[model samples]
Target chain A: EPEVTQTPSHQVTQMGQEVILRCVPISNHLYFYWYRQILGQKVEFLVSFYNNEISEKSEIFDDQFSVERPDGSNFTLKIRSTKLEDSAMYFCASSDDRGWETQYFGPGTRLLVL
Target chain B: SQQGEEDPQALSIQEGENATMNCSYKTSINNLQWYRQNSGRGLVHLILIRSNEREKHSGRLRVTLDTSKKSSSLLITASRAADTASYFCATDARNFNKFYFGSGTKLNVKP
Candidate 1:
C-alpha cells in the first residue's frame, strides 16, 4: 500500500537554528497535515494544507512555523528558530479528498534541539 | 474530560484474551478514529466510525461510538502478542480539518 514518507528520520540542531522537515505524501492525496508529539505528551495539531494553501492551524503554529508544498508531492515544515521545548516527534500525514477524515501518517521525524 | 480523552492509561492481558479501550470527548465530532503505535514507531490507522454510525468492525477489531454520550470504545477479540501497542482515539470535529487525539491507552499482551 502507498504510504506517506518523511525525510531525515532524525535531526539534531542547535538552539536558535533553523530546521526543515520534509514529507512526500501519497501521490493522489489532496490534503496534508503536520502534527507533533512531545515526549510523553498527546499529539498536537500544527497545521493543515490543501490546494497549496494553509487551511487551518492551531495556536501552537505560531509565526516561527511555516509549511510549504513547493512541489506536487513534497510538503515541508520549517521552523525559523528552534527552542529547547521544540524537541519532539514531528509527524506528516495525508488523506485523499474522498476519505478526508482518515489520515495516513508517516514514520515521523524526531527533532532534537539542544 | 478533554476532546478525545481515553480511559485506563494502561492495560495488560494474556494472549487469546480480549482487550477493550474506552475514549471520551467533550465536543460534537464529525467522526472518531482509532490509531495504533508500537514503541517509537509511526501511528497506524486502525478504524474510523462516523458520527451517524454506532458500530463498525474490521476483522478482529470492533469500534462503537455513542455521540449522545460522547464516548467510544475499541474492542480487540482474541488478541495476539503483536497486538501490544499504544491505542489512541482521535476526533474530527465538525468544520475542522485537524484531529484532536487522546492521550492513548498502552496495551501489553503477554504471550
Candidate 2:
C-alpha cells in the first residue's frame, strides 16, 4: 500500500535555529496534517493543509510554525526558532478527499532541540 | 487539544486472550479513530467508527462508538504477541479536520 514518507528521520538542532521537516504525502490524497508528540505524551495537532493552503491550525501552531506545499508532492513544516520544549516526534499524515477515508501516518521525524 | 481519554493506561495479557480498551470524549465528534504504536515509532491506523455507527469490526478487531454517552471501545480478540503496542483514540476537532490523539494504552501480550 502507498504510505506517507518523511525525510531526515531524525534532526538535532541548537536553540533559536531554524528547522524544516519535509513530507511526501500519498500522491492522490487531498488533505494533509502535521502533529507532534512530546516524549511519553499525547499527540498534539499542529496544522492541516489542503489545496496548497492552510485549512486549519491549532493554537500550538504559533508564529514560529509555517507549512508549505511548495510542489505537488511535498508538504513541509518549518520552525523559525527551535526551543528545548520543541523536542518531540513530528508526524505527517494524509487522507483522500472522501470524508470517510481514514488518515495514514508516516514514520515521523524526531526533532531534538538542544 | 486532546478530547478522547482512554483508560487502563497499561495492560498485560497472555496470547490467545482478548484485550479490550475504552475511550471517552468531552465533546461531540464526527468520528472516532483508533491507532497503534510500537516502541514509540510511527502510528499505525487500526480502525475508525463514525458517530452514527454503533459498532464496527475488522477481522479480530472490534470498535464501538456510543455518541450519546460520548464513549468508545476497542476490542482485540484472540490476541497474539505481535498485538503488543500502545493503542490510542483520536477525534477531530470541531469544524476542522485536525485530529487530536489521546494518551494511549500500552498493551503487552506475552507469548
Candidate 3:
C-alpha cells in the first residue's frame, strides 16, 4: 500500500538555527497536515494545507512555523529558530478530498534542538 | 480546546485475552479513528468509525461509538503478545481537516 514518507528521520540543530522537515504525501492525496508530539504528551495539530495554501492552523502554529507545498509531491515545514521546547516528533499526514476521509501518517521526523 | 480523552491510561493482559480501551470527546465530531503505536515509532491506523455509525469491525478489532454519550470504545479480541502497544483515539471534529489525538492507552500483553 502507498504510504506517506518523510525525509531526515532524525535531525539535530542548534538553538536559533533553521530547519526544514520534508514530506512526500501520497501522490493522489489532496489535503496535507502537520502535527507534533512532545515527549510523554498527546499529539498536537499544527497546520493543514490544501490547494497549495494553508487551510487552517492551531494556536501553537505561531509566527515561527510555515508550511509549503513547493511541488506537486513535497510538503515542507520550516521553523525559523529552534528552541529547546521545540524538541519533539513531527508527523505529516495526508488524505484524499473525500469528506471524513482517513489520513495516512508518515513515520515522523524527530527534531532535537540544543 | 477540544480534546479526545482516553481512560485507563495503561492496561495489561495475558495472551489470548481481550483488551478494551475507552475514549471520550467534548465536541461534535465527524468521525473517530483508532491508531496503534509501538515504542518509538509512527502511529498505525487501526480503524475508523463515522459519527452516524454505532459500530464497526475489522478482523479482530471492534469499535463502537455512542455519540449521545460522546464516548467510544475499541476492543481487541483474543489479543496476542504482539498486540502490546499504545492505542490512541483521534477525533475528526466538525473541522474534518484537523485531528485531535488523545494521550493514548498503553497495553502490555504478556505471552
What is candidate 3's lDDT per residue for A1-114, written digit by digit as tens? Answer: 999999899999999999999999999999999999998999899999998899999998999999999988899999999999999999999989884589889999999999
Model 2 chain A — which ten-residue stretch has the worst lDDT? A95-104
On TM-score, the leading prediction is 3
Off by over 4 Å in 1: none
Comparing 2 and 3 on lDDT, the stronger one: 3
Cα error, residue B15 of model 3, in Å, equals 0.7
Which consecutive 10 residues in model 1 chain B have the weakest lDDT in total? B91-100
TM-score of each: 0.98, 0.96, 0.98
Residue A6 miss distance in model 1 (angstroms): 0.5
Please give me the DockQ of candidate 3 compared with the native complex: 0.79
lDDT of model 2 at position B25: 88
Each candidate's DockQ: 0.76, 0.72, 0.79
Candidate 2 lDDT at A89 equals: 97
**lDDT by residue for model 2 over B9-108, one digit each (tens)?**
9999999999999999888888889999998699999998988899999999999999888899999999999999999999874544777689989999
Q: Candidate 1 vs candidate 3: which has greater DockQ?
A: 3
lDDT of 3 by residue, B1-111 (tens): 766899789999999999999999999999999999888788899998999999999999999999999999999999999999999999987787799999999999999
